[model samples]
Target chain A: MEPSDEALCQRVAKRDVAAFELLVERYQGRAYRLAWSIVRDPEDARDLSQEAFIRLHESAGSFGGRSKFSTWFYRIVVNLCLDHKRKRRWWKPWAGDAADDQGESFLERQPAPVTDPVDELGREQTMKDLWAAVDRLAPRQRAAVVLQVQEELATYEIAEVLKCSEATVRVHLHRAMNALKKTMKNMEKR
Target chain B: MAKHPETDLVPYLRGELPPAERERVARHLDECPDCRQDTDQLRELLGELSRSIAEPPAVNWARYRAELREKLEARRGRRAWWWQPVPLALATSLAGVLLFVAVWGVGRQVPTAGDPVAFEEAAIGRNLGLLEQYQVVERLDLLEEDLDFMSDLDGLAAGRPG
Candidate 1:
C-alpha cells in the first residue's frame, strides 16, 4: 500500500530522507504546474518549485496535520509566487512591441523539440491561451483559478492555499472563470 | 432547498452541485429552453477545460528525482548537524536582536572617550559659578531694596514722631 501523505509527512518530520524524496516526487509536478500557472515562466516555476520543496523539508516539523498535505504544500508555492510577483512589480517594459515581440520570440526559441506532434501543439496552444487568460485576471483570482482548475484542488484546499475563506475562494473562482469566458469569447471572434 | 436552475447552472456544469440540486437543474433544464441553451454552452466550456490539460514539458525524471533526493539529503544532513530546533533558533534570533538594540542604546547613552571626566567636571563647575554669581547679584538687589525701605521709614518717623 502506498504510504499516506500524512505518514510520509510524519517520517519527513523525523528527517527520513526517503520519506522526503517520496513527498517530493508526489508533489513536484503539481507544485511546478501551480507555480508555472501563476508566474507564467518556466525558469521561475522550476526555481519556485525547488524552493518550495526545500522549504517544506525545512519546515516539515511545523506541520500540524490540520489540513491536507497538498493544501499545506500549495500554501508554500503560492506564497513564493506572490513574493516573486511583488518583487517584479517595479520593472516594466517601457518600450512597445519591439520588447514584447522580443520576449515572445525568446520564449519560442527555448521551447523543446516536439516529440508527439498532437500533444505538443495542444500543449503549446493551451499554455498560451491559459497564460493569456490568467494574465488578465486579478492576481488573487488567477491564483484561485490555477489552484482549482490546474491543480485540481477543491475550494476548501484552495482557501487554505490562499489564506482566505472558502467563500472567498469560490468568489475568486467565479470571477476568474467569468473573465476567462469573456476572454475566450473575444478570441473566438478573432 | 433547490436553487433556481439558472443560479445552479455553473456549479452543475462543473458537476459540483449537490445530487438533489443537480437533479433539479437537470429537470428544470429539460423544460426551460433558455437555461438549457446556457447549460449547453457552460457544459461545452467545462468540457474544453477538461480536455485542455496541457502536457508537461519533457523532463528527465531520473535526473530530476536525483536532484530532489540530493536536496532532501542536504536538508537532513543540515538538520543532523547541531540539530537546532526552530523555537530555539527563533529565541536566539530574538535575543540577539534585543542584545544588539541594548548595546546600541548604551553606546549612544554613555559618553565616548574624546573628552575626559575632568572636562565634564569643569563645565559643571562653570555652571555652578554662574549660578552663584546670579544668586549674589540677587542678594545685592535685595540689599538695595532694604536700604530704600530704611530711608523711607526714617523719613516717615522724622515727620510723624514726637
Candidate 2:
C-alpha cells in the first residue's frame, strides 16, 4: 500500500529525503499545473513549483496535522503563484484572441500529447480560453476559480487554501464566473 | 421575461441549488428561452473547461530529485552548525562581534545630527580669527595710518573749539 500523506509529511519533517522525494513525485504535476494555470508560463511554472517544494522542505517542521496534506501543499502553491504574478507584467497571454484561425495553426504544430478525442481541438481551444479567463481574473477570484473548478477542490478546501471563509470562496467564485462569462462573450464576438 | 434568471447562474450551473429554488429556476427556465439558452451556453463552457487537467511536460525525475537532494544537503550543512549547542555559543559571539563592528563603522562614517553645527561653529570661529589678524592685528601699517588720521581730526577739532 502507498504511504499516507501525513506519514510522509511527518517523515519529511525529520529531514527524510526519501519521503520528500515521494511527496514531490506525487504532487509535482498538480503543483506545476496550478502554477502554470496562474502564471501561464511553462518555465515559470516549473521554477515556481520547485520553489514551492523547497519552501515545503524548509517549513516541514511546522506542519501540524490539522488539514489534509494536499490542502497545505496547495496553499504553498497559491502563495508562490501570487508572488510570481505580482512580479511579472505582460507575461500571461490574453484569453479572447486564441480562437482565431492563427491559433489553429499553432495548436496543430504543437499539440498536447493527451490524444483522447475529448482532449482534441474543441477542448484545447477551451483550455486556452480558460487560462486566458483565469489570467484576467483578479487575484483572489482567480485563486478561487483555480482551486475550485480546475483543482476540483470543495469550497471548504478552497477556503483552507486561500485562508478565507467558505462564504468568501463562494463569493469569489460567483464574481469570477460573471467575469468569465463576460470575457467569453466578448471573445466569441471577436 | 427578464433577460437573466433571478438565481445566480454559477451555483445553478454547478447543480448546487436547493430544491425549492431549483424548482423555481427550472420553472422560469422552461418559460424563458433566453434563460434556457444562457444555461445551455454555461453548460457548454463548463464542459469545455473541464478539459484542463493537471498535465506536466516530461522531466527527468531521477536527476531532478538528485539535484534537489544536493541543494537540501548544502542548506542543511549551512544551518546544521547553528542548531548545535557546542558551536552556537561561538556563532552567537561572532554575530555579536560583527554587529558591533558594523555599528561602529556606521557611527564613524555618519556625523551625528548635532556634529555638523558644532563643526560649522568651529570653522566660523577660525575664519573670524584669521580675518581679524589679517585685517586688524597683522596690518600694522594700516593701523598706524588710521591712528594718525584720528589724531589729526582731534587736533583740528580742538583748534577750532579753543
> Taking candidate 1, what TM-score does its chain B reach relative to the real chain B?
0.42
Instruction: Report the C-alpha lDDT of model 2 over B22-95, residue by residue, as the tens digit.
Output: 77788888898887787787776666567664455666767766766776678779889777787898989999
List runs of model 1 lying over 4 Å from the truth: A93-131, B1-8, B19-37, B65-162
Q: Whole-model Cα lDDT per candidate?
A: 0.70, 0.72
Fraction of the true interface contacts (Cα pairs closer than 8 Å across chains) found in each model: 0.11, 0.26
TM-scores for chain B, listed for all candidates: 0.42, 0.39
Tell me the TM-score of each prediction against the true structure. Answer: 0.61, 0.62
Model 1: residue A190 alpha-carbon error in angstroms: 3.0
Share of native C-alpha contacts between chains A and B (below 8 angstroms) recovered by candidate 1: 0.11
- Residue-level lDDT of model 1, residues B11-86, one tens digit each, is 6676776798778888888777777776676666655665665544656666767776677678778766456687
Q: What is the DockQ of each candidate?
A: 0.14, 0.18
